[model samples]
Target: MTEVFDAIVMYQRDHKEKDLMVKMLTRQAGKRMFYVRYGKSKRYQFAAEMQPLSMSTFEGVINTTGLSFINDVKATRPTSFLMTDIVLNAYMTYIMGLIDAAFVDNQPITKWYDLVAEAVTKMEKGLDPQGIANYFEVQLLPVFGIQPTWGQCVICGRRDLPLDFSEKLNGTLCQQHWDTDPYRMHIDNRAVRILSKLAEIDLHLLGSLNLQDKTKQEMARLMDKLYDDQVGIHLRAKSFIQQLTGWQNRMINRQSSAKEDES
Candidate 1:
């Protein structure tokens, strides 16, 4: 029997037999892989619908082994820009890719799906991609049961001062426990306040914080470390983002040096 599901594409890849394996977070069925016939030749492939970050209705037949064969796809949202625009393309890649790395198959992903959908729409509305990515990381980490304890010390029941963030302990540490772990990431009050605000804010309304670059870097570093130490699913897109950031920094430095030489 064939079934239809409203879904958002999370990750996609080429199959060995000239087909496509599209991993989607669906409204009804959670995460699913839909294998499309003739997905490579473009004669039958719905490129827009098959692209990652697209919300589309997927009509497919599920096999006994839980795999699905996509019969058709109809785009439910305008997602062509996700492929065409370079910046949006990269943002969607990381956003949906993180979701892909976070959840298991066929689980109840309705909330996560809505979160991804909303994030995509927010990006389209001109939200800061880096901040949005950080927001997604902070939100998704909790879903995987690996969030950092923000307000108080993980030891001695102290809430007066949160001094350090320990990825190994998965929470904040006070001065007493600060040097206890050599691997603890230092957490000043400012960074703690920033992370606390990140943890508490509504994702939909989080685009205009005016955070400093250092704060943003700290948030991203802590989130990535938490995902690595606890969640254990390595996100592939994150590496690419880092590379892009490094390249941009090098270009900026080169331009700065040129200006200094001229002066």
Candidate 2:
């Protein structure tokens, strides 16, 4: 029986000597692997449609075990920007990796499918991709079996005081209780506030990031620490983003030095 569904191309890799294995997060099913064959000329026929983060429709027989097979592929949405924009591609890659890590195969992923779709749409509409990525991370924490309290202190339940993240407590620790956990993450309050906002904000209503460099750095650091301590999943896609950030910083420094030399 053939089925039709829309999905985001998470990634594809070599399946065999002559075939490719494509993974997609489908609206009808969770993460699925499809076996794609090389064309007559010994080239991948659906290369463009299989690009990571591209929205495509798959006509195939979905299987309960092993790899499903795709009979036809169609572009369900425009993804040229996602394919061409390196920065967006990097962020989306990390986001997709997180989603893949959060759920198991063959699980019903209707909500997750909607979330990924909205995140892509938000990025497409010029929302801050980093912020959207952060939002996805915060929401996925629960799927990773970590439910951090964002509204108030995990210990005292007070929301008025400045807070810091605590992996031991699995949530925020108010300043009043800082001594309770010696290893509490001493991040900027602004960054902590941003995390709380991301945890609660709707993806549909998410707005401009408008975050300063220092705040963004602090937020990213805190998130990396928490995920490392709690989730313990490290992704190469995330490492690639880190490398990209380093390159961007170096490029900015070089341009700044060039301007100083001209002056």
Candidate 3:
């Protein structure tokens, strides 16, 4: 049967000469794949939206067994910020990869679809990329049956300000609990507060907040380990983003040094 759905392109891969398989997260349906008649080339009108984090409307046909083929697609939204800014692009990649890792094929995760669409839209509108990403990361937990308890220590139920996080406990610990394990991910009250705020803040208001670099760094470190240790799933997108950012930073540094020498 022919079907039309609102979807965001999450992943894409090229097959032989003129065929590309595209994966999408539909708003009302589960994850789905559709085949583009022509390869993802410059000539393809919908080529730009075939990349990760692009939102589009999909028109296709599904067979009896639920496999679908794409007839046509039109871009609904452009994640222009992600493509224009390297750091933002990396963040978008991480978001896409994280979702891909978290969900199973053909599983309806409309919540995630909405979450990504909103985040990317905000990012496109000049919202802080890291802030947008952190917000999504915290929200992603519950969809996968992993809601974090941040206000109190998950281990002993201590209500005092948390000092560190325990992967075993899947949350933070008080000072007393933290000191015993030297290898625990050390966290200050600020980090915890950031996490709390990130979890609760509305996407539309994300642009209003000014996040400190320290808090962003801390959250990045904490959440990376949390996802790996607690969820046992390491998102490759994080590493890719880090590498891209690192390389981009080095280029900027080198350019600055050359400019200084010229001066």
Candidate 4:
């Protein structure tokens, strides 16, 4: 039996010769993998719409006992600009990988699909790629029930405390808590405020906001640690981003400086 659905291509792998294996995050059925023959032929080369972040329509059979095969695929919007720019491509790849890792098969996360679609559209229209990525991470956490406590102290529940997002407490920690625990990751009030604002804004408006370099760097670190701790590892695309953004180079320089200082 064949069924039709709207889907976003999450990842694709070339199989033997002309075959392709595609992982799609569908609006109706969630994450699913499908096999397609002649997927690489000139006539169907546009079917490379199966590449990461392409939104499309799919018609296929759900193989109850074996690998599923898709009979028809039509690209709705290729989101092709995600591939044209280096920074946008890396951000989209990381977010797509996050969705692929977190959601289960056939379980609908309609809101997430919409958020991703919107983010891609914004990027295509010339939005600040880094800010959009930070916004996506903030909004995504709440949807997954992994929201970091930022409005108040995660440890003491003190609403009046100074803002300091500490990973040790898993949220914004008050000064008292920070003073008591020397191991906590100290995030300043500016960073905490930016995170709080990012969580509250509509995804479409993410492009309109301006974020300081320091805040963006801090938020990136916070998000990287959060995903690594929750998802058990970082996405390779994210590491690619750190390299492009000079994050890895800075760390190496800092380590070298520290070694020289010790000597």
Candidate 5:
């Protein structure tokens, strides 16, 4: 029996000479892998539509053999623009990869599916990609039952203290908690306010918020560290960003200069 699913292509890998294995996040079946025969052939080169982040409809058969064979695919929304810009492409790949890793097979995540679909649509429409990514992280974490408490301390439930994002504690830690721990991430007041606003803003308004470059960098760092600790992996796109922005080079140069000054 064949099943039809609405899905977004999460990844694709070469299987054999002309075949490919496709991983898709489906609305009905959840994350699934499908085998495509002769996917590289000239006649069906359009099947390359199975690239990461492309939305499509897939028809395939599920059997007990552990791999499903996809009979046909129709592209519903090709986010080709995401591929046109290098920075956006890197960010999208990282975000999609993180989501793909976070989800388990056969789990129903209709809300996550909607979130990703909405995010992609916004990206295609020229939304600020970085802001969208940060907003998504704030919203996505809670869906996985790992949402961080931003307005108050997770331990004392104190709402009057300033917000400090600590990966060690997994949420905002008050001054009292910080004095005790002494190792929490000291998030500034502006960062806290921005995070709180992001949590409340709708997806459509993501691009409207104008954050300074420094604030965006700080929020990105905090979110990346938080997710890295929770998810047990680092995003490669972050390293790519560091390289593109010359941040790593500057850090290295500063270290060298400090050593020279000591000498």
Candidate 6:
């Protein structure tokens, strides 16, 4: 049966010599695969709408156990920036990969669908992609069977003290209990606060990230360690994001040195 639904185009690949296989996360039908034929037909004409990270409305047959087919399509959101910006594309790829990792195929998760749709829309509107991605990563932890204690200290259950993240403790450590874990990550307190905020943030209401560079760096380190220790899944897209960040940092350093030399 043909059904109408909104979806995010996750990724696509060549199916055969003359067709493409498109994978989309549909709001109503979950993740479904559709075949976009390469011919002068309406399906082929709308094939461009299947670009990665783009949101579109689809009229298609959604099957539970096999490949579905697309009948018609139209863009549901403005994603010109996602198509043109390489960095945004990288973030998009990583975000899509993350969703795939967190859930299985053909599983209808409307809440997660809404969250991911809002996140991509935010990114297209020029919000910080890394910040949005970070929020998603934190939210996905529970799906990986990790429930970090971000609300209160794991040991003393205190909420009034400054907190530090302890991978060994698998949660936050209050100032009074910091000595309990010798390996507690002594990151910027701001990082811990941001993680707490991210844990409860609504993606629909989240604003632009206004974090200090040091705080962002510290948060990244802490999150990386946390994921490595607890959730061991790795995606190549994440490594690409790291490489992009490395290049950005190096370019910033080069420009700073050039300015200092001129001064």
TM-score winner: 6
- Kindly give the stretch of ten consecutive residues in candidate 3 with the minimal lDDT sum: 62-71
| Residue-wise C-alpha lDDT for candidate 2, range 1-263, written one tens digit per residue | 89888888898887667777888898988999887777212466667777778888878888988988878875568878888899899899899999999999888798889988998888888877777778888999998988999957999999889989888888999999999999988999989998898998877777666877778788889888877878899999888887988898899899999999999
Q: In every candidate, how many clashes are there?
A: 0, 0, 1, 0, 0, 0
lDDT against the true structure, per candidate, is: 0.75, 0.85, 0.74, 0.75, 0.74, 0.84
* Candidate 4 lDDT tens digits, 45-153: 5466667778887777865445676777654776667777778888988888778766777677878888888888887777767777777777777556686787677
| TM-score of candidate 3 on Cα atoms, chains taken together | 0.81
Candidate 2: count of backbone clashes, pairs at least 3 residues apart or interchain: 0
Which ranges in model 6 have alpha carbons more than 4 Å from their true place? 39-43
Per-residue C-alpha lDDT of model 6 across residues 1-263, encoded as one tens digit per residue: 88888998888888667788888888987788887777234546775687788788878788878888888874467787878988888888888888889899999989989998888778867787877778888999999999999968999899888999988888999999999999889978888988888998898988777777778788788878877778997788889988988999999999999999999
The C-alpha stretches of model 5 lying farther than 4 A from their native spots are 62-65, 142-145, 153-162, 174-181, 199-207, 247-263
Clash pairs, candidate 6, are: none
Q: Judged by lDDT, which candidate is best? A: 2
Cα lDDT tens digits for candidate 3, 117-145 = 88777776777777777777887787667
Clashing residue pairs in candidate 4 (N, C-alpha, C atoms within 3 angstroms): none
Report the CA-based lDDT of candidate 3 relative to the real structure.
0.74
lDDT of 1 by residue, 1-263 (tens): 88887888877899887778878788777787877767776676587677777788778775545677777775478877677876677767888777767777877778877777787777777776777777777777777877677657877758676567877777778878887788888745566666766677887776665656677667667777777777787666788777777787789899999999999
**Candidate 2: 10-residue stretch with minimal lDDT:** 38-47
